[model samples]
Target: MQSFFKTNWIHSLWLILLFAGSLVGETVTPKDRLIVETLIRLNRFDVSGNEKWKGAVQRYARSQRGEEGYFELVEQFSVEAELPELLRLVEEDPTSALSAKSVQLIFRLGEQKKLSRLLSGSPKKKANAIITLIGFVKTPEAQKLLDEHKALSAPATSVAKGAPALISTADDIKALAARTGNVKQGKVVFQKFCFACHKAGDLGLDFGPGLSEIGSKLPKSELLLAIVKPNAGISFDYEGWTVETKQGSFLAGIVSESDEELTVRMVGGVSQKVKKADIAKRTKMKASLMPEGLHLAMSEMELVDLVEFLSSLRTR
Candidate 1:
């Protein structure tokens, strides 16, 4: 009898501990692919929803609260009605992308009247927000604010300083790739630059599309084009998307697919789906999700090596 009672007591204690952990979010795992995928699919970019969507949002928000997904939820949910919440978060965490996205939504929602008030906040906070603003708003007022704060921002770490500049043009780079390609050295270069967003063989994450079989697919010229000017041919499923909703929220991602439902996949590999009726406006973006000027960071030989490495990715 005592053994059975002790077993029940241990089981009850274990359950209580798990319940407590769930309440504080200690049970939340960042690498939980199912939860992450669910968060992505349910996000319609519009938080103003019916009971069903609202419950999903609230449930996930509670589970993922205080995680990065929480900030993402706050950012996705930012609308005209939520400006006060956005502003408070921006003021508290100006250096965060969450705050930057909030600021972008404010401008897109035609709430420029509030900009001056944000500018009047603490000089450092205002400056941080302005750094994100100048890129979106090109007006003289915005430019002037940027000029004042630009010097305060830290410069990006240089990938390549003053070095021997042999060639940068696409034709020349391709020719270089044909001549002196070193797969091993190229792998090193890729690990340094592209590995974070790309998966090559067993290396790196799947944030961007996997390149394990890229060489088998794309010809040499096409590969060169992808390297030099990524925007020249945005992949069909990977095309960029900028979404705005009637609630005043803004979202940017790659629109993966939309039939009865729409799916937007973010750069971090999180995908969200929304009903077709919920999206206020969706635009195909003009730019590649990959940033330009990556070649500028590499030595001429480094570029050749990287291309050669990618080109070697043929059949198994």
Candidate 2:
């Protein structure tokens, strides 16, 4: 009787384990729903001309939109119903967040003619839009417009005091045309000053984003800003900080870490590692470790060359 009872209990436990495994298998999480729902909604919109699915798109865009998915939708949709509305919104209220998003969409669509018309109509909106779009499209037409605007008016100095001074000239046009960066010289400068924080190809520190294609993604002015005033909140990322510990061991640098280790690249080009365990606490310093006078460190022509070098680094 005792032996039979033990066998039955063991069988019951096995059944419970099986049931738990099945339950785990049957339950669907957000990750599972995200791909299927996103794809299904994308396909549904692609097949039908209905704007009904736009709510889903907006939700996705607002919540957790992937770059691939966003660009895919942009590529697939030709109707462009939202764009006209966005453009109208911008015209009515240029400073609206909706207008800014609309301008971004226009640039993403690569509708240069429409963008040009919008710019012609509204100078302030055009200035902001142009600055944003310069990161994406570096076409000759865009360059010409930027040149024309700069010629007519001074480039706005950022509110940040002592912003890196930009010298705008017709010569800028020539530099833009030549696309000249002494890569050999740039490689040396990059290694000496930039490599401690930034990484390119297989070399340099990975504390900063890879610069293999930075030249292609950013304009000369923006790149210069990144070097000089790195803490201007340009994007969701790249804000530099320094951290201090209660133990009186303060580290001034950007925090680059992974699951295993926390790495800090100090302001004066020293890289240090603190074990994840030893860190009692950390605080963020407001300024960027990217030196303020880096532009001054290089000659004007060299700076232009470096800009030329960085501008040419495009992946696509």
Best by TM-score: 1
Tell me how many clashing residue pairs each candidate has. 3, 3
How much lDDT does candidate 1 score? 0.60
Identify the runs in model 1 with alpha carbons over 4 angstroms from their true place. Answer: 1-13, 16-151, 154-159, 162-171, 219-222, 257-260
Residues 1-316 of candidate 1 have per-residue lDDT tens digits of 9999999999999878767765765353333334445656875455465544444454555465446555456445433445565566667755444454455455545565565566545565354334443343333344555555444445422446543253457766456546657899998878755654577898754556789988898766566667777777777777677776676555566665557667766543444566677789888878876655566667767777787888888777
Runs off by more than 4 Å, candidate 2? 1-181, 234-237, 256-281
How displaced is residue 234 in candidate 1, in Å? 2.6
Let me know the TM-score candidate 2 reaches against the reference structure. Answer: 0.38
lDDT of 2 by residue, 1-316 (tens): 9999999999899777656744665333344346437666665445244444453344343332223344234434422544565467557654333343344455435564676666656666445534443322223444665566556556531233432245345465445435556766766556544654566666564555679889777777677667655666434455555444445444444567889667765322234566667676766645553545555445655665666666666787
